[model samples]
Target: MIEQEQAAGLNRQQQEYLDVQGYLLLEGVLSPSEAVQYRQQLLALAAQEPGRINPTQHVRWLVNKGADYRKLLLHPAVDPWFRHLLGDDYALSTLTSNVVRPGAPDGRYHTDFQDRVPEPLPEFPLTANSLWLLDEFTPENGGTRLVPGSHRWRRRPPPDLAVHPDEIRIAAPAGSVLLFNGGVWHSSGANTTDRERVCLICFCLRSFMKPQFDFVHYLSDEAYAEATPELKRLYGFTAWPQPVDEPAAPKRRL
Candidate 1:
């Protein structure tokens, strides 16, 4: 159980929302200026390698792209919530962005790590996903479609439903932060609007799971130097066991 002090950043309502629906929308987590800046940064990066931008597919390792990525990495508002869900020993598994271009195709509904992990997920959360909206998510603009309470399901959702009754189109303004259990079923909607829809997602997991990105090699020395203690730990400078346990008995002379 999360202690009161550990979960202080989340109010009663937010906790209840997460507990019941497996997702929560945090409005105004970023300012308009911040949102614009992030979107511009993402656009610039995409322009450099336009071929790499796939519709509804994630672009990995935003940390390797710009300094602003670090801001989202260590945002205070999310720290406590992550701690509440994943505990202090959690490690950041993935930091990536996705852009749903105008006329992009709809994504298949799925869970993040559920298919990969073993069956019968533990009662407590092993991973949490934090999404930072760089553009307003709307039904016409291709907002994320999520199935409320689907995270608690032990089995995969059937694909028969073109639109499930429980599915909720997350129509939220830019600068919002959407946090959800990694087990929740979700997908990107088709974008009919004229502009692109941009967003960044951070996946944090319990120390045991292998992270999606190899941060140790990806993060530059300068970035590593600038990283906070928590960031350093998450980046895996401290995840390994320092010294191997010594043998109880000394080796016999040959």
Candidate 2:
């Protein structure tokens, strides 16, 4: 049961849509200029490690890269919704950009977390994914495809059901934001266009799960020292054990 007031970031209609569809597309959350800037930054980061770019997967952990990337972690438009769905103690598990080049192979349909674990898919939202589209998403450009309500499905998608009738491709302008539960069935469409398709994906999870990246060790000391309390917590520094007498709020060094 979603409370409209508790989900103030989303209206009743939007909340209902997410409840039924398992995902939501908030169009034009980032301005065109911001989109271009993000695309440039992400591509530049990719250029730094050109050899690492793989056909099906081209991702780089970016929370500690630059101020721009760090600021994106707490973007006003999508952060509230993540907190609402994942709770205040949720962790920003991984922040990486996906670079899908022209002619890249189709992404196999699957959930982010469910496939990693055994059968009897877990109930409830243990993790969530927020995608920031840096380029316009279209069929020719490899827009993402999702099975509308499959997030609630108890079983993994069978191979025979790969071409699901209920699946829909998301086509939106640059700067749009796409968010979904980790259990939602999804895959990237094949990129047949001449240009590259870029998207920043933020994988968030309940604090209890292990994060994909080690933020505490990898994050720059300077950045960690200046980060806000909330950002610090999201980076996992505050997630480790703490004294019983200490207040829940993170303060001082661990």
TM-score of each: 0.89, 0.89
lDDT of each: 0.79, 0.81
| Residue 171 Cα positional deviation in candidate 2, in Å, after optimal superposition | 0.1
Candidate 1 regions exceeding 4 Å error are 1-3, 159-161, 241-254
Cα deviation of 182, candidate 2, in Å: 0.7
Off by over 4 Å in 2: 1-7, 116-118, 159-161, 242-253
- Model 1: ten consecutive residues of lowest lDDT: 245-254
| lDDT per residue (tens digit) for residues 1-254 in model 2 | 35654555557787678767889999988889999998988888887886787764556667777777787776778876777668768898888888888898678887876557766677777788988999999977889988998978856777555668888888999999999988888889889988889999888988888888888777777678789988988988788776568566664566
Q: How many residue pairs clash in each candidate?
A: 0, 0
- Write candidate 1's Cα lDDT for 49-148 as tens digits: 7568676546677777667787787588887777777777788888888889999866778777767666666667878988899999998888988899
